[model samples]
Target: MSVATLHYIHDPLCGWCYAAQPLVSAMQAQLGDRLALRLHGGGLFGEPRRVDAALAQHIVHSDERIAQLSGQPFGEAYKQGLLADEGTVLYSLPPIAAVLAAESLDAAKAYPMLAAIQNAHYQRGLRVVEPQVLTELAEEIGLDGTHFAQALARADGHTLFEHVQASRRLLDEAGGHGFPTLLLEVDGRRTLLPHHHYYGRPDAFVQMLAGQLPAVH
Candidate 1:
């Protein structure tokens, strides 16, 4: 049997990534240890940037479309609070570092940490760029807050920068043009899988990948 790895290229603040959370969950449940699921943060907002009115409008419009197509909820708090706030920042590095920190402590906690961060931004209207917020999210997912914070601190400087760069390289190598790209690697060869059609339908996503997966025995 050949080794299989699924690379998920995404950004913490990307609305489509939030929408694809369910598909990720389905993949985990169905594939289990037979396939290695790796997350790559694409650093959509590598530099710290505040959300301007125009950007907020664009994000709201894009989020609405994502919710409509993927059936993911954009909470009232997000819509009425975050988007409406003029002082909101859209930095991705802090949240990405938080995910990396969780992965360092426990590989299984990585995805859950990402999910929690996404929920913090898209559902709870929390400031994911804040260190306290990221730490709190980690604790919510069962990680010891102090350890998580320390791990986050360790990943803060050069480590997080390197990870983001690596993820971007993977995106380029995989021929992915945007966030939420799924690249499946069997043995050594790689193929980019379709993600749009599978939105709001994780069962279909699993079924499609089922064919590409090699027999276990």
Candidate 2:
């Protein structure tokens, strides 16, 4: 019998991805070895885009909306401390590269590392651009900080570009052009997983997955 795989493609800086984390975790726990999970880094920001006044306000409002809908916490500090700094650049490649590096070392650690980066950004208001911050997150996820840092530094230029290219290819192939999209592949067939509306219960997501993919064993 062939095993089924779940490919969760998302961007690290995406709010909806943050909201879906718990639901993915629940599905993984229930599905166990019947499911093989893979993380694809969907690059949300390709270049260093300046956060203009309008964009900043939009981000602040989007963060609030995500918090309200997903029950994910967003503190005033995240808005005031991080977003208030006008020069804050939004380039997610570095952090996304860090996740890919961690996955190379140990696949199971990807989600935890992703969560650590998110918490550092949205919860603690830390700038994820700094290498020190990424290294600290690596340590927190049981990865060799030095190795992870070296991998990130080496891959900072070309490897990340390649990963983003792969992500783009996947997105194009799947005909998906949205953040927080979930694609599950079973028996060589790929299908989109249904997502609950922005603020719906995570359990609703679990039920949807359960109905779509039953246990193989």
How many backbone clashes does every candidate have?
A: 0, 0
Could you give candidate 2's per-residue lDDT for residues 1-217 as a string of tens digits? Answer: 2277777778888888877777777767777466777778878987777777888899888887788777888766778877888887777888898888788778788878888888888888888777888999999889998899887787678888888888777877887757777787877898977664624476677666667675655
lDDT by candidate, in order shown = 0.90, 0.78
In model 1, the Cα lDDT at residue 177 comes to 82
Name the best candidate (by TM-score).
1
What tens digits encode model 1's per-residue C-alpha lDDT throughout 1-217? 2269889999999999998998988988888667788989989998988888899989989998998889988888989998898898899999999999999999999999999999989999999999999999999999999999999999898998889899999998888888988999887888999888889999999888888989877
Question: TM-score of every model?
Answer: 0.97, 0.91
Best lDDT among the predictions, by candidate number = 1
Candidate 2: which pairs clash?
none
lDDT (0-100) at residue 184 of candidate 2? 79
Q: What is the lDDT of candidate 1?
A: 0.90
